[model samples]
Target: MMASAGDMDTGSVLLAEKVTALSDPAAYPEFTAAVTAVETHFSWVFLTDGFAYKLKKPLRTEDMDFTSLAGRTRNCEREVYLNRRLAPDVYLGVVDLMATEDGRLRLFGSGRVVDRLVRMRRLAEDDCLEIRLKRGLVASEDVARLARGLAGFLTSQPPLGPVSPVGLRHEINTSLLDLAVACDGCFEQAVRRVTARLLAFLEYRSDMPGRDRLVDGHGDLRPEHVFLGPPLRIIDCLEFSDALRRRDPVDELAALGMECERLGGAWIGPVLLEAYGKAAGVFPPAGLCAFYRGLRALVRARIAVRHLMEEPIRAPERWPRQAAEYLRLADRAAAELTVPSGRRPSSSAAL
Candidate 1:
């Protein structure tokens, strides 16, 4: 039972309200003094209808953290700068928060330096890709268009010089490790099987070719972060650190594929890969797609676990259920790797 678009939108609005309440004047003065309103979630997002102010929360997670004011501000600035690379029309600039003589909060930088916000042009909620996906409004053509668009972006960008193979290995392993810790006993056997598959993949590919062509990518590439319009827009990149953002493009593609499968659209994996390959002149490495797909599942599992741990009371009891969904996908992906035909294609395979 997947949540409907309407339900998800309602949830987002509720989350917005919760975020506002949590960051209200009485809750945290520094954040309150910096923005007029907060939109809450992952980070405290403040907005004025016309513009958005994103303030990183001083929270830490296995994947990311904005523990200090300076760290938050740095990440905020990075968000604006990096997002502009893909979405120039949106992502205006960083707004600074300034304190008045009377001790009132105000937006600065464009005027005076008081506090900081990652200012961006506000987009309509209805236009969000996540909303569209939930509503069954995202057509195959839309997915094709998005794939072509992303492929073009990757092709035009220069490769991020040789990423350490060890680093890539660590990225996949760390995600599985975190998932194992998070799941504990709920799905011990499933988690263990997935972990073994991940380790095997890493071990088998330790000496694969073309490891130097990896590039900086959207660590969190999903429908929610994409905006569908005349031209599709990918936003909300993992700006907390470059380590996560820099990786094999296949890993990014795998993240999208796993999400699509989870959302009941397994066909999208091959569709997107075919489209991307047409634009980039190459598909993901042989035998690696399944591995990355498993890794993506593991990452989602970690996120589900994090939600359960961080917001036990607020977190849905359905989290373990959702985590199970990802685990199932991981198993499927791992199984695909064992098939003789799975490793046959180098660049002509559909997915």
Candidate 2:
């Protein structure tokens, strides 16, 4: 996806608008109750006392646009719609951040709307799955329970028919290419290993042809996005792209497995895989699981190293190490891509 000069100019203009209009805390007086504001990839999140406000950044990518109000509004609506499938209680709705005549921004008020934001109920921060992973407190029961719950969640949505083989290949290759370009410093060798495995898997699609119908699911079903129960809530689906969000259940479960293995909970990964197999009555192909898990690891590794691109001179102290760790996970998972190189296994044994 090479960018044209016009595309570059358009992206720059949109980025400038976001930085100028949405970045200032002082601009949004209606958010006076906000405890803090956090920046995500393409949105700004304001954490109020009981609610969270996520404002789109009006940014542009080759495949996505958050620049126009109509575009943002539709995406905002889609965000609520898709996320409600998993966390109905959490994604409250969408609200307009209108610009008042007096030049101040008011949220959910009558005026000319400047930007659209997805409003959500804030989950318990301390109880996020990351904290549990960090403390080594995740019980086998918890993993099993999450697996069962996730299986139900994945199966709840009606299948959208088999995902296109070509589209699936594009999805994996695009991310892998970007990763190779983004984390070349510490990632070159390991990335080559993972890329080779993914390429091999891509070639042998008949063996792991993703037979399941795609679900509109949590595209980024990571530990950090999950909350441990009393009531389990997974917030922040990839609202920006439907192609990225649509996935087979096995692929989605494998993503969680990848993250678990990354964060020192290696035992938890196999438990999740086993749970999914038992609950869903689907023995996901070994190579398919390994490919999905490795691809996800490489994706996370790319994200971690993007800070170098953003602030090469003074990126965070921890990112290089984090990137290296992710790359190692990528290599390990890729190397574990079992079954013969070009042989096609029975695509579904448990189904």
Candidate 3:
């Protein structure tokens, strides 16, 4: 389902509209585009009244690359396909530009192909789980509902194949190596300790039974990507590569737990885990909670480091503080794994 630049229309109609939207309109004189746009930690999303168009920047990271128009188109198509699994009602379709008789860019062609766009039905921003939580609209019942919904989704899908186990490990190792390189001397020891623990855990579990129980999962299941609506809808998957989404179910839960904790809902992790486990008819391996907690922390640390690495020019004034927080989380995760009982107070118990 990967999209390519050739899929869009070469006509100037749609192209003109999109070109005008960018802050630097003059940069693209070929198309008469106009729209208000905003940048995120990852993509440059342009907003129109009725629809939203996402354009992947020419960015590269440890796990992904959107360096070419072709790559971006493919990723955008992947985004539409994968997100539809959870949010079928919201993900409309891919939008493309077509060429007109005079070499003008239009939307989908009555003519020739131009640039590709992922067109989506716009949802109210306030409906996002992150926003709802910030507005004090989220409740414990809502968390429980989300847990049940995700549990149902995970249980219904088949487990990942054996090939995925090796792939997942490689991704974890790669991310850890990147983190180790980016961390300062003060934080390197902590990062190394946690990374080592995770590596050990991966080694021990690689041969464990039930490899098929793992499946392709939402690689970045943060609150921000979840929409709190009639039904919980997860969106914006890691579409650039398969390595990001292919993981253990517990790993997915752990990521969500870490996000909940960071958002001041310390108890939600255990509550959600308990609910999901009950629904799935199994408990995660004993020490895995600890292992994935450490893994999640390290993942977040790596992400923060990647952000700093990718765009040092726009580094937030709080970049140092953010880095420090990630390091602290890594230290805490390492300590948690080494404890006699891996099940310490919930990772988010104090929020």
In candidate 1, what are the lDDT values of residues 1-351, reduced to their tens digit?
A: 011121131222233333454344443323344435643445667655355667554466555655544655777888888887777888987755544455434453133342356777777667677787677777778878988888877766678776564665565556566666665676667776766656655555554425566777777898778887766778888887787788678778878888877877787788888788877788776477887888788778766765665542344676788788888998888776553334332221111
Tens digits of per-residue lDDT, candidate 2, 1-351, equal 211122132223343354455455555544444357677666778776677778776556765776566777888998899788778899988886665677656664466666668888889877687889988889988888888888889888878778665665555555566566663444555676676666666665566666566988888888998887767777778877877888877778888887887788888888988987899887787878887788777777766766555522344766678877877887888887754654642332100
Best by lDDT: 2
- The sequence of per-residue lDDT tens digits that candidate 3 reaches over residues 1-351 is 111122132232332354553434332223435556777665667666556667655565556656555666788788889889988987777766555676555453376545566777777787787787677787777777888888887777786665343554555566567666664654566666666655555554543325565677788888888887866788887777786677677878877877766676657678878888887787776466666766676667766666565433365555545655755665565565443335333322111
**Best-to-worst lDDT order:** 2, 1, 3
Instruction: Tell me how candidate 1 scores on lDDT.
Output: 0.66
Model 3 residue 205 CA deviation (Å) reads 7.2
Structural similarity to truth (TM-score) of each candidate: 0.77, 0.81, 0.77
Candidate 2: residue 321 Cα off by (Å): 4.0
Cα RMSD of all models vs. native, in order, equals: 9.0, 5.4, 7.0
- Candidate 3 least-lDDT 10 residues: 1-10
Q: After superposition, how far is residue 208 of candidate 2 from its true place, in Å?
A: 0.8
Quickly count the clashes in candidate 1.
Answer: 7
The list of candidate 2 runs beyond 4 A from truth reads 1-34, 163-165, 171-176, 179-186, 204-206, 303-320, 339-351
How good is model 2 by TM-score? 0.81
